[model samples]
Target: MTAQDPNRVFKSGFVTIAGAPNAGKSTLLNRIVGQKVSIISSKPQTTRTRILGVCHRPGAQVVFYDTPGIFAAGDRFNAKIVGTALSAVAEADLLLAVVDAARPDPAAEELLAEKIAGRRLPVVIALNKVDLIAEKGALLAMIERWSDRRGCQAVVPVSALDGTQVEELVAALIAALPEGPPYFPEEALTDATERFIAAELIREKIFRLTGEEVPYASAVTVEAFKVSADGRKVSIAATIHLERDSQKGIVIGKGGAMLKRIGSEARREIEQMTGASVFLKLFVRVQKNWRKDAKAIERFGY
Candidate 1:
């Protein structure tokens, strides 16, 4: 976890967060990075890709990868998502293993452990959502449990929601990094483009506003992103892809009210992200059973 030289002036490396669904990995990353590079929701598997965020400090820059949750998969689609979660652990110089202390799932934690077992990377466990646990003894017991886990360099309890012990977690991660110069520029927060973020913001609205299989069966793609000549506003044209024809009416809503709600909420966030007023155009289209087709998943940028 340290460079060969004891007096190295700088340190930089990648830290990938691996854990179960709704473990607060994305929330932790957003808090540490101080921006909304990854969207958050109560739903599992909200993050599908390798979302990269760069944390720039005075002497170090820690790059982070927020991936899909680790879960037991019985189908092709879920297996792909689980693969993305596991792949990130191997590529980083350090790993942050997060778990929900209030709602412990031994099965999911064990699955996460199995994937990272016997790896040489520096591992730090963050028992997240500690604020939800009222009993001090329970927190102590859980802390002891994770401390005994093999291959862990540090065990720090945190609450990503209220900024409790998060700075301590960040300090632990920075201490484990090897000596190197900053990997990204000082002003840079993430590598994601505006178009990709706009699409994700739109998808986040669907996940929060809709229910059942509608969120899982849907994806977003940006067709047009054009800035005006004076650069005061952005005009975006995007489509919400659905796996079944029946889901279209659900997203479109009665008298287009649902779509209007999703669009208005998404546009405001995009405005905050781009610092420009946005004119967003959303459309719904169905490609039958797209999740069942591997080619369709790839085409959707999954």
Candidate 2:
């Protein structure tokens, strides 16, 4: 059964994108879905929960769930984050194991292997960031290495950032999906709401712009989202929750410059998404070690 079948049955199922931290799982999801349903950053642990995006094709609707990166979940907080990713794994019909071809983390890879071992799920390994590989032999070796490690449906080398061989990867995933009705409407792109996506966009900007403990300690919550008549404009009130007063100072910057910058950047993306003018207001507050506290984690939607 190949992806190019002329008379293929309509297929749809959940394909959970799973891998270690910074392996380009979210990047691949966004690329395949053709939208930024999940956030991405250079920082590890940027994704904290499951983000679902639907890919509509000729004969199949591929529902993709982007999971948080797998890590050494020893501490309680880390354990909770890892638990979220594991739960998504339990819901997968096909596992798209995306691995970074540029940088390898053996410990995290071992952890991922252990968690999915004996699950009997059909796995497809995507060697993302292949465009970064100057040596074609190295990419082939990695593909061979992954193929020998597991009985994957396919081991595809791709550059999720550059859309290299992504179509092949998509066809492989959709081909693996079981025959069924679409989980979401053909026009639907993601399961997340506007409020959630807006907040995520804000957080993504923070991750991209900030340095040190700022991104790790920060979480955004949309306090109020009001849309005007006919939905041409939206007014949003969101808070950037931090772990310390010092961190809040860092985000606020001199004369509220940093906060303004984050808000401006986030608002532009929100406008593009909503196709409406976004009036965004961001406030920074200290939650004081919220990442370590369970209640705070829940409050932050992690």
Clashes of each: 0, 0
Lowest lDDT sum, 10 consecutive residues, model 2, at 1-10
> Taking the tens digit of each residue's C-alpha lDDT, what string does model 2 give over 22-130?
8999989889889889989999989988999999888788988899888878777778888999888888999999899887667777888888877888899998898
**lDDT by residue for model 1 over 1-302, one digit each (tens)?**
23334565788999999899889999999999999999898999899888999987756789999989999888888888889888888898999999999898889889888888877777899999999988867878878888787878899999999999998998889888888878888899999999999999999999999999999999999999999998889999999999887799999999999999999999999999989999999999999988889998898887
lDDT of each: 0.91, 0.88
Residue 293, candidate 2: Cα error in Å is 1.8
Clashes of 2: 0
What is residue 182's positional error in candidate 2, in angstroms?
1.2
User: Which residue ranges in model 2 land beyond 4 Å of their true spot?
Assistant: 1-6
Tell me, what's the RMSD of every candidate?
2.6, 2.2
Candidate 1 similarity to native, TM-score:
0.96
